[model samples]
Target: MAATVAQPTHMTRAKHWNEEVENAYRFQLAGWRDQVEYTGHKGEVTTWPNGLIKKLMRKSDECWYYFNKTRECADKDINKCKLYTY
Candidate 1:
């Protein structure tokens, strides 16, 4: 869809996801474009109206992860987004 700048593949998703986790509470996040710049990362950076990284691990919708891109560390740690509860 033109609305979306890039469609991250399974691999990209995994890579980005890991990096995001590694830099959990970080604030300045390296957007997907930064990861696989050769691919559509650039496009995603430009086209995406709002730069929002879906911090998901267990693969569940309606989950809102509170990640501090500035701190480079997830507030609740990877897979510990402040979205849902058990």
Candidate 2:
């Protein structure tokens, strides 16, 4: 999981996808996703700032879902750039 630091794109630049990044991707259990703050959530409500991959996925997912709910226009360019964490 050690990739060279390439140019930053849709995916946030991780310092380097190492063991630490992999472990963070796994947050104990399914409920770990709840830790990420969305539109209507309490506590430390915040976007998925866990890492580059998570951040990209979360943002894109949120945008997509929001558009679905509110019928907003989606960003064609960004939407085209799918996150490839695995």
Top lDDT: which candidate number? 1
What is the alpha-carbon lDDT of model 1 when measured against the actual structure? 0.31
**CA RMSD, predictions in order:** 11.5, 14.6
The most accurate candidate by TM-score is: 1
Q: What is the Cα root-mean-square deviation between model 1 and the actual structure?
A: 11.5
- For residues 27-63, could you state the per-residue lDDT of candidate 1 as single tens digits? 2233222323312322322211233343422113323
Backbone clashes (count) for model 1: 19
- Model 2, position 38, has a per-residue lDDT of 24
Output the lDDT of residue 62, model 2.
Answer: 28
Tell me the lDDT of candidate 2: 0.28
TM-score of candidate 2 to 2 decimals: 0.19
What is the lDDT for 15 in model 2? Answer: 46
